[model samples]
Target: MAAVVIRDPLAFAAIYDRYVALVYSASLRVLADVHEAEDVTQDVFVRLWRRPETFIAERGRFLSWLMSVARNRSVDELRSRGRRHRREALNGDTSDDDPATLVPADTDDPVLAAQLHEAQKLVRAALVGLPADQRRALELAYFGGFTQQEISAALHEPLGTVKTRIRLGMQKLRRALENRV
Candidate 1:
């Protein structure tokens, strides 16, 4: 499908239709703002359309790569604004937390929905199992889109220490999700 998308840019519509919900959900989970999430979703698709080769078939599944892009873009939006707590403090906004709710009701495929829920559980579990310092560093880097220097500055830790924590955290996460991912 990536090959098809690359060969025919117009064919991207099909891919986008299939995965936009997941991408938007990934962004919304991080941004917690519908407008910002929509912007990130559009940016992710545009970048893919312009640079289809970025999706290397040999590296991993397209869905995984696309989700990473969506997440990173959402984090980038957060970093750009320099706001750690931008989400609204509304009392009844639990929609973003449920994987099933993230998928549109019209396109609700139980298998894919279940897979998303399972993946979220697996990742949350892996993150929870890490040491506090490692988990914080990884969350800041991956979820907050902060660079090592930025993390060091924000956390008041040495840059080297921040880097080491992120590296160790990633290694552990990779090991934990090796078979499942």
Candidate 2:
């Protein structure tokens, strides 16, 4: 690996080729926005190229270390953007009834609107089925855009418990909705 870092150009290129997709996918999972994910993915590789000496094999496998960096960076980006979005919302600079503010108003076709409406109904039903605490946690985190720590403070629950509830609630919701669909 060190030889690849120092002596062989093709070996470094091979490493990038092997790991680029994994890094991009990890970024996409955290970001959920294609353009932002793509930008972050490129940045991750650029950082790796600039600081190949920073990666120590003793800490973990190369891909594992790379993935950890990618995931952390993506999450940090999301949290930063989320904070900015919440600040904007709190300032009341946004229009409440603007469809564009919530979701894109113009769909390319009617079928897309029907599919979106159906998905919304299924999600609503799933939320209604959750236990009150779990539902509240999910709502505050998802709709209100509160972080787990914020939700814990707001609901007077431990941060770990709030995170667990949200994770479990989402797992159950996914299963239930899968069966329905």
Candidate 3:
């Protein structure tokens, strides 16, 4: 069935219909957002439709491969959203934004301000590219001013998972920036 999907695009619909619920459920479990889950579900099927040969029978079951794609894509969406917020904040778009509240711009030195702005944008993009769990944990702990315990309760995730997400997320962010330099 998986092999046939590559040859015939219509057959892909059957595969999507069979696993859409399970895939969307896994996405919602990770993301906790209905709309994001739906987007992730659509993304997962799109990836399959575009590259059906990516799934080889010798590798494993199609369902398992599809599940991995769904989870990873949901996390990607989470990170992307975070980056967008970071960009908005840096641009001084807060509802109650004041000059002092902005991300430390140097109006007197346009070159320096531009450099800082570009660096911040790079960081924002990296932050948003992180895994969804890590991005959420970092946002809550750093920007949201929430304690780890509070985040765990609010997200209804295991305390250890929250801790691990933050730790891993930070490490990945650091590595991502370092590689660029």
- Model 2, 1-181: lDDT tens per residue? 6756674678667667666766776576456566877988988887777778779999888867998888777767766785654433222222233344244423433554566557667877887889988987875554345688887876788999999999999898998898564
Against the true structure, what is each candidate's TM-score?
Answer: 0.71, 0.52, 0.45
> Model 3 lDDT vs. the true structure?
0.67
Which digits, one per residue and each the tens of the lDDT, describe model 3 over residues 1-181?
Answer: 6545546756776566566766776666556566777888988888788777777879987766877777667656655676443333222212242344233455434664576567768887998899977987886654343568877877799999999999999999998899562
Please report, as a residue range, the 10-residue window in candidate 2 with the lowest summed lDDT: 88-97
> Which scores higher on TM-score, 2 or 3?
2
lDDT of 2 at 132: 80
Worst 10 residues of 1 by lDDT: 86-95
Alpha carbon deviation, residue 165, candidate 2 (Å): 4.9
Candidate 2 lDDT for residue 3: 58
After superposition of all CA atoms, the RMSD between model 1 and the true structure is: 4.5
| lDDT values, one for every candidate | 0.75, 0.69, 0.67
Give per-residue CA lDDT, model 1, range 3-55, as digits (tens): 55546755777678778888887677667778888999999998888888888
How far in Å is the alpha carbon of 177 misplaced in model 1?
1.7
